[model samples]
Target: MVELNEVFETNTMIRDENLDVRTITMGIGLLDCCDSDVDILCDNIYKKITAVAKDLVKIGDEIGIDYGIPIINKRISVTPISLVGASSCRTRNDFVKIAETLERAACNVGVNFLGGYSALVQKGMSAADRLLIESIPYALANTEHICSSVSLASTKTGIDMDAVKLMGRVIKETAEATKDRDSIGCAKLVVFCNPADDNPFMAGAFHGVTETDTVINVGVSGPGVVKNAISKVKGQNFEVLCETVKKTAFKVTRVGQLVAKEASRRLNVPFGIVDLSLAPTPAIGDSIADIIQEMGVEYVGAPGTTAALAILNDQVKKGGVMASSYVGGLSGAFIPVSEDRSMAYAAEIGALSIDKLEAMTCVCSVGLDMIPIPGDTPAETISGIIADEMAIGMVNQKTTAVRLIPVIGKKAGETVEFGGLLGNSTIMPVNKYGCKDFIDRGGRIPAPIHSFKN
Candidate 1:
């Protein structure tokens, strides 16, 4: 475990400030909750969750206070609802009820978010799955704390054009449904390609079938620590910045590994991966973009910002791997436009462009995240971006995902503030060129040549 009082010398690359882990999610496998009767299955799920997770918030708070490091969120992820409810849910209403139960369970425990109300129909969708997908807008808008996601592609089965189209429509409706609340409900939703099973982050986490019955995973976030490391060497050369990031990330991941193991031990659950993502908050001076800007750029999205981010991302992975044997999730620097204040500022000033953002995703954690587009942008355009990012991940055989917000009645350059953790961002323009023909191809883009290891 990381010693909180390890004092640092002024010249050391690593220094512990207010750095802390964001959330340590406990995923409880709910596949056994499946039943022939929808109501009975829902009842069983609520009972199981309530019984086991009743003390989640209390226990997490105790640990956080004891360690003097704030655990910002305590949450849970369950098996994808479509999989767990496959035997029970014959109609869309049944899925909605199940979603409601999940929401209520989270609220009962004071957990802020409950993920895995999702499906993994990367290649195709079953009828029940399709209905569940269609109902996301209503479910998310109406529920208080439910999050949803769908994996539309993987390195093995490739991208599913039809599922992508349906998800695009769902994204649009989800935005409209919560437009009154600045689309706050939409913030709880994520669309993924090559999603990770042990992710402790919000909006994209799920308990995959291969996971233990229950496991606790921690997501340690330290953008301020990383920014501090970069700022200390502002006038240094690029190589110096990379080395600084690697050394700082080593210390940061050490803290995460310690926190994760301790939390799991306290909970009496098996320890899971430590998601070493540089997840940002709306707080000023606490962003990955700020780190890049501190490294000599006038602002984020300047000429060398993407390259700098690439270096930071790589070094973080290298250092984190050395610190923990169980490093996983989207473990890198996240450049979500809305989540990072500097990223939003860059987009507002036109320093960041869609193409540049796409390139950044090639090296960073996820793709096209928290990006808002003009409401009128065609569904095909959304599918095009999804396809493009998924293609990159598939070809590279790494996890990449998109969590776009098609902000209704909002256009490029317009700023929308969702408030709180969702943060604020100026909308970005998408390519005007149409992709109707490509999207209409509407079949799996076969797994890349390199994916065939056998």
Candidate 2:
């Protein structure tokens, strides 16, 4: 039970620390909506999503108002459309039609984003998976509010280099398809290694087959709260700093638990899990970099940046588990470049490079998120980058993903404005060296020997 003192503490977090529930995502399974006819299948999908999520926005708003907590986004995740549309979708256009239906449903239901226009090709690709991956550029370009992800690697199955090579081309095509809008389509696409089923965050959330028909998942944000808590312990030893962070994360996550239960009760959906991710926004105080700096780093991406991130990530999880009975999803510090103001600043000043960001991902939540490269980057180069990240996740047996935006008509030093929660970013340079020969060797990378644990 939450004590009265805890209620007051949560109020302080909200009032001063930019505390908010990042997203209240509803995961709707679409296996039941499958049909042999394309039009009929699209109709079934549209109807099911609309009906299931009609009240999601209303309930989320009411919850935020009643509890005086800010719920920033109401979103939805559906079963991967590649599987649902495979029997009926004869061509890439047919899958694009499904994407349009998803966008329409998301708009109708008043949700900001609808994820799961996705394909799973971790080990290899089915014909349907290949079609979905090929269609992603057109699908995402033609629609707004629809997000797509493709899984190309996993710890147990290893990396699918065929899919990796294909996705590198797909990402380039996606950027070209939406070049008029700052290549925003690529922003909605994610490539994953070891993707999770119940992740409340996007652009890589999908309802895994293991989930219930419908459920509510909450992603909580409290980087500012953490930063504030750590500041008070300045000059203290590492032990004191770690304990302070843990206690701060505990208080922040308790608020999330309260909101999740209330939302689940009101919406009449099973409470799935509370994602205790310290999601950072473009806002000044709400930055993972700032928290790292408060922990005494000179700047993010400095010499000791990775170590600071490791401490923050571990303590956040340790404390969050104490607060919530079910804590899943990518629960750690997020260091998305364009989304965090301090990280963006660091990148612009050359204090942070793509290499440093990649190194930091080894210790953080996700990999290479919202990073903008030059417009002329080669597809093979992008694939090489994805391969490196996939290898990390496969070896470490953790979730990692890539969301890269190659802004068209822009060079490394220029800035592209996506605005809103996506924020703006100065294009970071990539290594000019060619990796075409390496990427051309398209076959599976065998799973590590450690994966033999039965």
Candidate 3:
């Protein structure tokens, strides 16, 4: 099955095209760690996560060395903390204490991040869910590696406007709490509609109840590889262009498949899916927007951007499905504003707006990610933004999420640097129109009629 030419092609992609495995995430269930006492519960969670993921970083580094393919991050996801800590947590401080324990465990294991400090309240919130949501700002401010997410909408169940409103205030508080650090705490928090349980990405990843005790999932990144392939067929027709992208995606995903299998075998954990998401970084030439421009769009937010993105997302799934039998977890293109250099430039120049980003999310993987807005922006306005995005995912039955940062004391056109993978962003302007009355009448938005398939 090994061919010399194919091997050479892969080597070229790695050396020049920014092709790499984005993450090797270990999903560890934490339901068994629950107890009736907060201290005991946190201790059990710490022990379980450390015991299961003790060797994750070592194995990830060893695999990268042996295979000569870069593995960017090693992370962990546990069961949603709300479910596991509900009976034990008496107050918001109890949740904060648990967050501290998670931070320690992540540091001890040497992982880049730890997720599942989350609550799933798509339709309604329990008493425990409210405590967790209220404590998010403080929890995130106190911990460095702990990430938080709250699910407020789904297709089967309607959007929880109450939770959406609460999240708006929570996000504002999170920004204020971390203002000294350029509001970095909000960067680690995500709001989701139809969130995926098996996602290998940060801020939105959790081990669903359906999963086993342990599993290994991989996320692949290759915007540069796809863009390079598109350049070769510059003057070709649509058929040729689509074929080129599909073939390039096949090669990129094969690398992820190989890494996933090897990591699972070495760790003695069951292999999960390969998430073929085109996750970009702050590095130039490795942007999803560049891939769109290669498809003939003048710029990222131009007229034909959405159409080009639709093609890229569809063909990537087509190619990825053929490369690996298990392709899941938001397996498409991601267009986070701060993480992608070109997208951030577009926003800085006023070429992109929040409305255009929302339109693009209808076809892309995640939505409205890493966007910075003015500090004085109203909480109702943020809730309106989340409501609109949730409507899109609910109607289309696709996953959409929001990670907005209301940078305290920052205005539009001003830059805030978050450093590292989060990069920097210029705060974008939002509509001044008020939607307080609309958000004040809080109730669930009814599910779509198409959800009656049963």
lDDT of 1 at 254: 79
Q: Model 2 clash pairs?
A: none
Total clashes, candidate 3?
A: 0
Q: Each candidate: how many clashes?
A: 0, 0, 0
Clashing residue pairs, candidate 3? none
Superposed model 1: Cα runs more than 4 Å off: 1-5, 8-18
Q: How well is each residue in 258-280 modelled by candidate 2, as lDDT tens digits?
A: 88999999999999999999989
Q: Model 1: what TM-score? A: 0.95
TM-score of each: 0.95, 0.99, 0.99
Model 1 root-mean-square deviation: 2.3
lDDT of 1 by residue, 1-454 (tens): 3244553431132234447778989899998888999999989999999988888889889887776667789999999998888887888888999999998889888888899999898889988788789889989988977889889888988888899877777888888898887666667888777899998898899988899999998898888888887877878887898888888888888778877888788778899899999998888867888888887778877788778888889999988889897998889998888988888988998999888888888888887788877777888888888888888887777788888887887788888987777899888899999988888887777877777778
Ranking by TM-score: 3, 2, 1
**Which window of ten consecutive residues has the lowest lDDT sum in model 3?**
416-425
Give the Cα-based TM-score of candidate 2 against the true structure.
0.99
Better of 2 and 3 by lDDT: 2
